[model samples]
Target: MKAAWLITIAPFAACEPVPTAERFIPDYRGVETMLLADDLVQFNVSMTNALSARDVENYAECAAAGYTLIRGWGFARHLRTNVDEEAGVWTADAVYTISPALPRGISTIDAEVVSAACAEKGIPTV
Candidate 1:
């Protein structure tokens, strides 16, 4: 009978592997910040299924800008960023020097302005 077969299949259903949704990124995914010194800070950002390296790098930059502003600094000098991709997750680890003015290099950013732009773009910051 149909009812008998339905009951038999119901027990077998629990043994089946559940399908996981494939996504470009998880909800509420973003960056984390750490301060190594008064002027030096680190940002690590990770996202699932990002398609481009630029997106990962931008995440770190956004974190750096927001971190600099929250520390009461107006400028940030990019130190370095290490990017990696594994499976479907992309990660960028970056460091920056926070200051009141450009650090005499080509790698300076305005914290207030950049952070506002990052916020407008929906990137998370500290």
Candidate 2:
């Protein structure tokens, strides 16, 4: 009986460990930026190994923040973000309004602050 128990436990010990953050590290594919209007912009981002929709949305937000800075803007307000995943690849279609002054919304983002956070998080920007 002891031998049987040891044999079962041995196989369990050999099993692979649980997934870690390194295992799920995302592969940022690319970002496409489009100017919808004077201050409105659209960001399309794609990636793989995304753990959740929030990852793709963050990518889009990062792109938007970078674009805002590039356009000499200091802020961006999130309009919308749509996330999709297929065949293990995640994509996000996001829209934002860039402005020199803070936009009148709760989703406003400071371009410099968000860009720095994105860099620290290893997320790519436009």
Candidate 3:
């Protein structure tokens, strides 16, 4: 019975030990600038009339996935136009601002992926 218990515990004993303060040091230099901000950031998002809810969901998802430092309230506008007249037609738009930083070691492919994901959600790239 003792032998069986030892055998069962042997594998668990081989697990690595948890790290301590001495072994793990926090790095603050990389985040110092972001910790201090004086101005608000903004962005503009515009979409076609056919925009769907999925697009908005995707935009929010992308924003969450990215490295956003700050965000601000957004404004939107809707316009109407006549088919025959191009000059008099008013335009519709939406504006929102978010300050995001590129994570260290982020590749171009990562950016493209994020952009595409946002586009899929209906968030236009600025």
Candidate 4:
């Protein structure tokens, strides 16, 4: 009985422990804002070590929110967002419309609220 116990303990001791995965941290690059029309706006953002396209998209959204606030608007509606990755740099092209009232769409965002949330998350906004 002692030998059996010793054999079992020896096998367990020889086994190696599993390695833990490292945490992922993204590096934000920069943002460029462009006014396509009177109420139409565009945001171009780039970043490295992005986990996914959603990260860049959120960056663009934050920029739009900040811009809307700067333009004295209360709300914005998301029109579209195109994401691309090249040589480890992620880029996003996003478009939005600004208005004083809630836009007629489900993708509308409250500029003040989104801007505050972006600031709290340490994300840069235009």
Q: Which candidate leads in lDDT?
A: 2
Please provide, for model 3 over 67-94, each residue's C-alpha lDDT reduced to its tens digit, 9 standing for 90 to 100: 2322322221111111121232212222
Clashing pairs in 3: 42-97, 43-96, 43-97, 55-121, 55-122
Q: For residues 7-116, what per-residue lDDT tens digits would candidate 1 score against the true structure?
A: 99999999988756755444336778888998988888997666687888888888888888777779999989999988877898999999987787898999888889
RMSD versus native structure for model 2: 3.7
| Top TM-score model | 2
Deviating ranges (above 4 Å) for candidate 3: 1-40, 57-110, 116-124
lDDT of 2 by residue, 51-76 (tens): 89999999999999999999999999
The global Cα lDDT (0 to 1) of model 4 is 0.91
TM accuracy, model 1? 0.74
lDDT for residue 65 in candidate 2, whole number 0-100: 93
lDDT of 2 at 34: 90
Query: Which should have the higher TM-score, number 1 or number 4?
Result: 4
Worst 10 residues of 4 by lDDT: 17-26
In the order shown, the candidates' Cα RMSDs to the true structure are 7.9, 3.7, 21.3, 6.6
TM-score of each: 0.74, 0.83, 0.22, 0.80
**What TM-score would candidate 2 get against the native?**
0.83
